[model samples]
Target: MKTLGLIGGMSAESTAVYYREINRLVRERLGGLHSAALILWSVDFAPIAAWQAKDDWDATGRALAEAARRLEAAGAEAIVICANTMHINAPQVQAATAIPLIHIADATAAALTARGVARPLLLATRYTMEKPFYRDRLAALGLPSLIPDAADRDRLQAIIFDELVKGVITPDSKAAALAMIDRGRAAGADGVIFGCTEIGLLIDPAELDLPAVDTAIVHCEAAVDFALG
Candidate 1:
């Protein structure tokens, strides 16, 4: 098996999910034979989150690039960022290492293509949704992208910040997120992309009539596939 390096903890919440999923997949695939060859660099998310709250991509990009270089030096065969939003710096991170950086967008687009989806709704941090980089990736794969309304984006961000990332899930947040799902369905979405890893904490495929894709799960599956070689 090849080694997997994780650029993680831009909120340890989703990072843990990625770790568990990789192990479970490997164990199921290989039947508990020493699990996956994994190396994780769980960085403090607080600094990056602060910059993000202020839209400081330059600082975050530099920090993340440094993290990628460190991981490469540590013998990682290839790398993956644990959070979707942090992937804004994916190019920089990839440049920092000779090893591959498995992009979340690549994984997601591949899944969408495999399912033959030509269009889909996107739900994520306001930065991720409003930003061109994220949607452009889906568009590059011939998928149409739809985003939530500004008010819905605000509500979703709050759930992500206060509840999901903090691991403080609550009944009220779940209901509110479901309402957002309703709005997305009305917006002509073929399906909703739960773009934020933490958002998956509040919603899932069965909660709404629209098909849902969890980016974290999709990304982890991709990383596992790459690692299994």
Candidate 2:
């Protein structure tokens, strides 16, 4: 298997999910005792969060680019950024590395398109939802995106940063998120994208009534495919 490099800890919670899911997928595919060959560089989220809050993407990109370079030097064959929000720096990381940077949005767009979802409701951090990076990626893949309104977007941001990042999951938050999904469905969203890496902690995509794309899983699957090839 090829070594996959991960730029993680945009929030440690979601990075753990990526670690677990990637290994799980490798094991399941290759049978018992098999696991992914991967290198993970998990960053401290606090300073990154502060930069994000300040809209200092250049700093964030530089940090992730450094991580990618380290992983490449350590013999990782492909790079994966663990969080959806962190993928805003994908280009910087990619430019800094020789190997492939497996993008979460590209994998997600492929998954959504394969599932025949015309418009997928996006539930993520405000950066991912409001910024052009992720949505533009999807559009380039021939997929349009649906998102919660301004107020609901704020709620999602709070739930992700304040609660989910801290590993706090509350029933009230889950209910509120579900309500947003319901509203998105009402708004003609045929599927839901767990655009935030940690969103799976709040809602199980498998249990959702509508078609759901859990980007963490999709991203891992893509990485595993590349690794095994």
Candidate 3:
């Protein structure tokens, strides 16, 4: 098995999920004592969050690139960013290493396409929702994207950073998110993309009427496929 390199902790909550899911998948697939051979470079989200708040993507990119390089030097065969919004710097991270960077958005888009979802509502941080990086990826896959309105977007972002990242799950926040999903459905979204890694921790796809894609799951599955191959 190839060694999977994970650049995570853009909020340790979701990073933990990625780690758990990846190992769980490997164990379930290979059975017995089999598990993923992996390395992880978990970053402090405070500085990364500050850079994001100030729109300092260059710094963010540099930091992630450095992390990728370190992982590659440590014998990682592939890289996984483990966060949807941080994918804006995916190119930089990929450039820093000879190994592949398994992109969360690309994996999610592929899954949506395979499921015949042409229009999916994206629920993520404000940066990911407003940025062209993610939407353009979906468009390239022949899938158009929908996002919440300004008010709802702010509410969602707040819940993610202020609550979800901190491991605080509230019924009120789930209800608000469900309302936004309903609005997206009304606006012609046939499916939902949990674009933020932390979203899966809050909402269960089984409860939603529309099909939902959990990016963390898709991304981890892709990594597992790559590793085992």
Error of 3 at 56 (Å): 0.4
Clashing pairs in 2: none
What shift in Å separates residue 22 of candidate 3 from its native position after superposition?
A: 0.7
Candidates ranked by lDDT: 3, 2, 1
TM for candidate 2 is 0.98
Q: What is the C-alpha lDDT of each candidate?
A: 0.86, 0.94, 0.94
Q: Model 3, poorest ten-residue lDDT window?
A: 109-118
- lDDT: worst 10-residue window of model 1: 203-212
Best by TM-score: 3
lDDT of 2 by residue, 1-229 (tens): 9999998887899889999999999999999899889999999999999999999999999999999999999999999999999889888999998899999998999899888898999999999999999999998888889899999999999999999999999999999999999999999999999999999989998888999999999999999999997
lDDT for 48 (candidate 3): 98
Please identify which of the two predictions, 1 or 2, would achieve the higher lDDT against the true structure: 2
- Candidate 1: lDDT of 116? 61
Q: Lowest-scoring 10 consecutive residues by lDDT in candidate 2?
A: 6-15
TM-score of 3: 0.99
Better of 1 and 2 by TM-score: 2
* Of 1 and 3, the candidate ranking higher by lDDT: 3
lDDT of 1 by residue, 117-212 (tens): 667788889899998889998898788798888998998888888778899989988888787777767777777788998878777776667667
Tell me the spans in candidate 2 whose CA falls farther than 4 Å from its real position. Answer: none
